[model samples]
Target: MTQPVHPPKPRPGDRVAVLSPSSGLPGLLPLPFELGLARLREDFGLVPVEYPTTRRMGSSPRERARDIHAAFADPGVTAVIASIGGDDQITVLPHLDRELIRANPKPFFGYSDNTALHCYLWNTGIVSYHGGSVMVELGRPGAMAPLTADSLRAALFTSGPYELRAADRFRVVDRDWADPATFEAEPETDPGDGWLWHGPERVVEGRSWGGNLSVLSWLLMADREISQDLSAYDGGVLLLETDEELPSAEEVFRILRAMGERGLLERFDALLMGRAKTWSFDRPGDHAERARYARDQREAVLRALAVYAPDVMAVFDVDLGHTDPQLIVPYGGLVRVDGPARRITVTY
Candidate 1:
């Protein structure tokens, strides 16, 4: 297995390249995107430099690749972050210059469809962040989640073990970004339930792998990004979560069952399951429906683990992926899952 290289840290005044490797929603919706950029400058004290394709809709894969190459190769660019993630980043991966990115490794932050690039970085042996998209978390309707702010702050500036904590409160509903009134107050949140753990008493420590389970399933079908030798993932920690699409619990079970059939399920010593996203704009679910959704999804995950990797240490409801107050998980970086101590830590 290739060990990952940590990129140089960005200081307050440094320039951070912000690009849209997937859909350039920044062009269509300037409200969240502009707010996000402002926060990067004022709150984080970093300058965000945009590329030609950063806000352009329908940008070609090669055009996106050029932007990535420019961002990474530029001496002034200390780090690279995505404006937001979209569905087709997998198409941009083949166009990337691996050597250029490898030579100028810097922290890349994104989740959801950005899983394509995260998997790409993992293959290149460079650690990248799996949360804190500019247009999503930072540009949230109200304000950045306090937990999210703390996690991003630590991930951007520090290089050490950071303990993961469950958010005291969490939000799943999104307000209209076009309405200026939406930004004036905080979003409603539900009380957080702490993490649920299962399996053996032993602690598992190793480099982390995996992201957005739906995206991983797609990669597995295409036979792209993931290693052919499943042993490469042995002893590694697997982090996974479902997105706002709100796939049924049966669908979740079937995906894990397929992974088990491929001999992929047993490769990891531990699994970190991000809290299942229960609500979407089109399908506005009630509180009871949302609770049922979360419960069913958790059951599906446990069902698969029981059949395929019974002894694997597992933790549920981790604040990563589609949920609010997201914590950044380091892709291809160190993760320590202490089952007995009920603690999780990742190097960011």
Candidate 2:
């Protein structure tokens, strides 16, 4: 297979497509979506053009796919970003015009359920961004986190090597976007102790792969974009993370164990485990509980690695997933993980 090509970056004055290829939560919760859109213009100096289904709730898979096709096919739109992630993007995959998106390569940004799209773009030999959705990172309550803003700015507009920074403070819990007062101040954050490293000391450099762990599991079950030929991922850097659903430690292990059973774990020399989003609206745990959740999840991942990919280097909590001060990882783009120096740099 050919290496994935980084698509053209958007300029400050360019008009970008704001799409809801997933759940279209922007309709139900317009506050963050609007806030995010304002930032796209005021903060980033880019105009956001929304499609008919961009904010419509309960949009069909075919409809979402149509919007996606239109966004990629539109020459005036320099980039495509998700309004937010949803649950059933897997269904949208069958409807995507692979040839169209491949022919019109543009920067696409999203994560979580959007993982499905990232994998699709990866297979299409085009690099898409695995971060910076409209509602989450850009529409963050209060002011956008400085780290998130800086990282997203680089990912959206720049085309070069960008180093990932460990956020000193981060938030795992979420606030209700519907509540007006939620935007009064920045979401509360706890002190981040920093990333935890495991395995051998060495540098590993390769194109990045993987996304939201739960989403990847769903994709695996559906037998979608994941190559059955295990050799396809050889020497690639794995990017994995849990979502706000707060999956159990056992669940995390089972998914990795399943991947290992398929001979997928050993293909990668290094793993960049994203910071676990421990607390959620459904299960609002205290700081201690959240910390324990994070710890147990790490243990689960380590157990899987020890069993299948013992030689693989692992770094936990690099702030790339559901965590605050999110960093962007270019899906299928070059990633250098220096275990000895404790650094990670990605080509945007």
* Predicted model with the maximum TM-score: 2
Q: Which window of 10 residues has the lowest lDDT sum in candidate 1?
A: 172-181
The estimated TM-scores of all candidates read: 0.98, 0.99
lDDT of each: 0.91, 0.92
- Residue 240 CA displacement from its true place in model 1, Å: 0.5
Q: How good is model 2 by TM-score?
A: 0.99
RMSD of each: 1.0, 0.8
| Residue-by-residue lDDT tens digits, candidate 2, 17-45 | 99988887899999999999999999999
lDDT of 2: 0.92
Q: After superposition, which runs of candidate 2 have C-alpha atoms over 4 Å from their true positions?
A: none
